[model samples]
Target: MTTQTYLVSGMSCGHCETAVRSELGAVPGVQQVEVSAATGRLTVTTDGSVDDATVIAAVDEAGYQAQRG
Candidate 1:
Protein backbone atom coordinates (compact mmCIF):
# COMPACT_ATOMS: atom_id res chain seq x y z
CA MET A 1 0.00 0.00 0.00
CA THR A 2 0.99 3.61 -0.42
CA THR A 3 0.62 6.24 2.26
CA GLN A 4 0.66 9.95 1.69
CA THR A 5 -0.04 13.13 3.52
CA TYR A 6 -1.66 16.36 2.37
CA LEU A 7 -1.98 19.84 3.76
CA VAL A 8 -5.61 20.86 3.72
CA SER A 9 -6.90 24.29 4.51
CA GLY A 10 -10.25 25.65 5.69
CA MET A 11 -11.17 22.85 8.03
CA SER A 12 -12.46 24.68 11.08
CA CYS A 13 -14.44 22.00 12.84
CA GLY A 14 -15.13 18.30 13.16
CA HIS A 15 -17.80 18.52 10.50
CA CYS A 16 -15.25 19.88 8.08
CA GLU A 17 -12.89 17.05 8.94
CA THR A 18 -15.69 14.53 8.52
CA ALA A 19 -16.57 15.92 5.14
CA VAL A 20 -13.01 15.73 3.96
CA ARG A 21 -12.65 12.20 5.31
CA SER A 22 -15.83 11.07 3.62
CA GLU A 23 -14.69 12.43 0.29
CA LEU A 24 -11.21 10.97 0.45
CA GLY A 25 -12.38 7.68 1.89
CA ALA A 26 -14.67 7.11 -1.06
CA VAL A 27 -11.86 7.27 -3.59
CA PRO A 28 -10.99 3.96 -5.24
CA GLY A 29 -8.02 2.12 -3.66
CA VAL A 30 -8.17 4.30 -0.59
CA GLN A 31 -7.96 2.12 2.52
CA GLN A 32 -7.76 4.75 5.22
CA VAL A 33 -8.15 8.49 5.74
CA GLU A 34 -7.31 10.72 8.66
CA VAL A 35 -8.03 14.43 8.68
CA SER A 36 -6.88 16.76 11.42
CA ALA A 37 -8.48 20.15 11.70
CA ALA A 38 -6.05 21.32 14.34
CA THR A 39 -3.12 21.10 11.98
CA GLY A 40 -4.80 20.99 8.57
CA ARG A 41 -3.29 17.61 7.82
CA LEU A 42 -4.72 14.72 5.86
CA THR A 43 -3.13 11.28 5.84
CA VAL A 44 -4.33 8.70 3.36
CA THR A 45 -3.52 5.06 2.72
CA THR A 46 -4.19 3.49 -0.63
CA ASP A 47 -3.35 0.32 -2.51
CA GLY A 48 -1.61 2.03 -5.42
CA SER A 49 -0.64 5.33 -6.87
CA VAL A 50 -3.60 7.62 -6.38
CA ASP A 51 -3.85 10.50 -8.78
CA ASP A 52 -2.91 13.77 -7.13
CA ALA A 53 -5.55 15.57 -9.15
CA THR A 54 -8.15 13.14 -7.90
CA VAL A 55 -7.18 13.85 -4.31
CA ILE A 56 -7.36 17.58 -4.94
CA ALA A 57 -10.74 17.18 -6.54
CA ALA A 58 -12.01 15.20 -3.56
CA VAL A 59 -10.94 17.96 -1.22
CA ASP A 60 -12.45 20.58 -3.47
CA GLU A 61 -15.70 18.65 -3.50
CA ALA A 62 -15.65 18.74 0.25
CA GLY A 63 -15.21 22.53 0.18
CA TYR A 64 -11.56 22.65 1.18
CA GLN A 65 -8.18 23.31 -0.36
CA ALA A 66 -5.51 20.60 -0.49
CA GLN A 67 -1.99 20.06 -1.66
CA ARG A 68 0.52 17.23 -1.40
CA GLY A 69 2.75 17.33 1.62
Candidate 2:
Protein backbone atom coordinates (compact mmCIF):
# COMPACT_ATOMS: atom_id res chain seq x y z
CA MET A 1 0.00 0.00 0.00
CA THR A 2 0.99 3.58 -0.46
CA THR A 3 -0.03 6.64 1.50
CA GLN A 4 0.16 10.13 0.13
CA THR A 5 -0.60 13.43 1.74
CA TYR A 6 -1.65 16.52 -0.13
CA LEU A 7 -2.18 20.18 0.63
CA VAL A 8 -5.53 21.46 -0.59
CA SER A 9 -6.85 24.95 -0.90
CA GLY A 10 -10.37 26.47 -0.68
CA MET A 11 -11.55 24.03 1.91
CA SER A 12 -13.26 25.88 4.72
CA CYS A 13 -15.96 23.63 6.08
CA GLY A 14 -17.23 20.12 6.55
CA HIS A 15 -18.91 20.20 3.16
CA CYS A 16 -15.58 20.95 1.55
CA GLU A 17 -13.99 18.00 3.27
CA THR A 18 -16.82 15.73 2.19
CA ALA A 19 -16.56 16.84 -1.40
CA VAL A 20 -12.82 16.30 -1.46
CA ARG A 21 -13.10 12.95 0.27
CA SER A 22 -15.79 11.72 -2.09
CA GLU A 23 -13.79 12.67 -5.12
CA LEU A 24 -10.49 11.23 -3.90
CA GLY A 25 -12.20 8.03 -2.85
CA ALA A 26 -13.44 7.52 -6.38
CA VAL A 27 -9.96 7.41 -7.83
CA PRO A 28 -8.86 3.96 -9.01
CA GLY A 29 -6.64 2.08 -6.51
CA VAL A 30 -7.60 4.41 -3.70
CA GLN A 31 -8.37 2.45 -0.59
CA GLN A 32 -9.14 5.30 1.79
CA VAL A 33 -9.31 9.07 1.97
CA GLU A 34 -9.11 11.54 4.81
CA VAL A 35 -9.59 15.25 4.36
CA SER A 36 -9.52 18.11 6.82
CA ALA A 37 -10.93 21.43 5.83
CA ALA A 38 -9.61 23.12 8.93
CA THR A 39 -6.06 22.07 8.18
CA GLY A 40 -6.25 21.97 4.41
CA ARG A 41 -4.85 18.46 4.42
CA LEU A 42 -5.87 15.46 2.34
CA THR A 43 -4.50 11.99 2.95
CA VAL A 44 -5.01 9.15 0.54
CA THR A 45 -4.25 5.47 0.94
CA THR A 46 -3.97 3.33 -2.12
CA ASP A 47 -3.52 -0.34 -2.85
CA GLY A 48 -0.56 0.49 -5.07
CA SER A 49 1.03 3.33 -6.94
CA VAL A 50 -1.36 6.14 -7.84
CA ASP A 51 -0.32 9.04 -10.00
CA ASP A 52 -0.24 12.54 -8.56
CA ALA A 53 -2.07 13.90 -11.59
CA THR A 54 -4.91 11.50 -10.98
CA VAL A 55 -5.33 12.80 -7.45
CA ILE A 56 -5.08 16.40 -8.53
CA ALA A 57 -7.80 15.82 -11.13
CA ALA A 58 -10.01 14.25 -8.48
CA VAL A 59 -9.58 17.28 -6.28
CA ASP A 60 -10.40 19.52 -9.20
CA GLU A 61 -13.57 17.60 -9.89
CA ALA A 62 -14.50 18.14 -6.26
CA GLY A 63 -14.17 21.90 -6.75
CA TYR A 64 -10.83 22.43 -5.06
CA GLN A 65 -7.14 22.69 -5.80
CA ALA A 66 -4.52 20.36 -4.39
CA GLN A 67 -0.89 19.40 -4.73
CA ARG A 68 1.21 16.57 -3.42
CA GLY A 69 2.76 17.29 -0.05
Candidate 3:
Protein backbone atom coordinates (compact mmCIF):
# COMPACT_ATOMS: atom_id res chain seq x y z
CA MET A 1 0.00 0.00 0.00
CA THR A 2 0.98 3.63 -0.47
CA THR A 3 0.11 6.56 1.71
CA GLN A 4 -0.01 10.11 0.43
CA THR A 5 -0.96 13.48 1.76
CA TYR A 6 -2.46 16.29 -0.27
CA LEU A 7 -3.24 19.92 0.38
CA VAL A 8 -6.72 20.83 -0.75
CA SER A 9 -8.27 24.25 -1.13
CA GLY A 10 -11.89 25.49 -1.15
CA MET A 11 -13.38 23.05 1.29
CA SER A 12 -15.43 24.93 3.87
CA CYS A 13 -17.97 22.64 5.48
CA GLY A 14 -18.95 19.12 6.36
CA HIS A 15 -20.86 18.67 3.11
CA CYS A 16 -17.82 19.73 1.15
CA GLU A 17 -15.70 17.28 3.08
CA THR A 18 -18.14 14.47 2.45
CA ALA A 19 -18.28 15.27 -1.22
CA VAL A 20 -14.55 15.13 -1.53
CA ARG A 21 -14.34 11.95 0.52
CA SER A 22 -17.01 10.24 -1.51
CA GLU A 23 -15.34 11.18 -4.74
CA LEU A 24 -11.99 9.84 -3.65
CA GLY A 25 -13.54 6.75 -2.18
CA ALA A 26 -14.96 5.83 -5.55
CA VAL A 27 -11.49 5.40 -7.00
CA PRO A 28 -10.51 1.71 -7.31
CA GLY A 29 -7.35 1.73 -5.25
CA VAL A 30 -8.23 4.19 -2.56
CA GLN A 31 -8.60 2.49 0.80
CA GLN A 32 -8.73 5.36 3.25
CA VAL A 33 -9.06 9.13 3.32
CA GLU A 34 -8.81 11.77 5.98
CA VAL A 35 -9.83 15.32 5.19
CA SER A 36 -9.18 18.31 7.41
CA ALA A 37 -10.66 21.50 6.02
CA ALA A 38 -9.45 23.57 8.94
CA THR A 39 -5.94 22.70 7.93
CA GLY A 40 -6.47 22.34 4.20
CA ARG A 41 -5.10 18.82 4.14
CA LEU A 42 -6.13 15.38 2.94
CA THR A 43 -4.38 12.11 3.61
CA VAL A 44 -5.03 9.09 1.46
CA THR A 45 -4.11 5.45 1.63
CA THR A 46 -4.25 3.39 -1.51
CA ASP A 47 -2.71 0.65 -3.52
CA GLY A 48 0.65 1.48 -5.12
CA SER A 49 -0.67 1.79 -8.66
CA VAL A 50 -2.69 4.92 -8.04
CA ASP A 51 -1.05 8.19 -8.96
CA ASP A 52 -1.32 11.75 -7.73
CA ALA A 53 -3.13 12.92 -10.85
CA THR A 54 -5.93 10.47 -10.24
CA VAL A 55 -6.38 11.72 -6.69
CA ILE A 56 -6.26 15.34 -7.77
CA ALA A 57 -8.85 14.73 -10.45
CA ALA A 58 -11.16 13.20 -7.90
CA VAL A 59 -10.78 16.29 -5.71
CA ASP A 60 -11.48 18.52 -8.68
CA GLU A 61 -14.66 16.63 -9.48
CA ALA A 62 -15.74 17.14 -5.91
CA GLY A 63 -15.29 20.94 -6.30
CA TYR A 64 -11.82 21.53 -4.87
CA GLN A 65 -8.17 21.76 -5.87
CA ALA A 66 -5.45 19.38 -4.67
CA GLN A 67 -1.72 18.85 -4.87
CA ARG A 68 0.44 16.06 -3.57
CA GLY A 69 2.55 16.45 -0.50
Candidate closest to the true structure, highest TM-score: 3
Question: Per-residue lDDT for 1-69 in model 1, tens only?
Answer: 988899999999999999999998889988899899999999988887787788889999999999999
- RMSD, one per candidate, in order: 0.8, 0.8, 0.6
Worst 10 residues of 1 by lDDT: 45-54
Evaluate model 1: give its TM-score: 0.95
Which residue runs of candidate 1 sit more than 4 Å off their true CA positions? none
What is the lDDT for 43 in model 3? 94
For model 3, residues 1-69, the per-residue Cα lDDT tens digits are 999999999999889899999999999999999998888899999987789999999999999999986
Residue 4 of model 1: what lDDT?
84
* Candidate 1 global CA lDDT score: 0.92
Ranking by lDDT: 3, 1, 2
Q: For residues 1-69, could you state the per-residue lDDT of candidate 2 as single tens digits? A: 988999999999999999998888877899999899988989999987788899999999999999988
Count of backbone clashes for each model?
0, 0, 0
For model 3, the superposed segments whose C-alpha errors exceed 4 Å read none
Candidate 2: which stretches are off by over 4 Å?
none
* Candidate 2 accuracy as lDDT: 0.91
lDDT of 3 at 41: 92
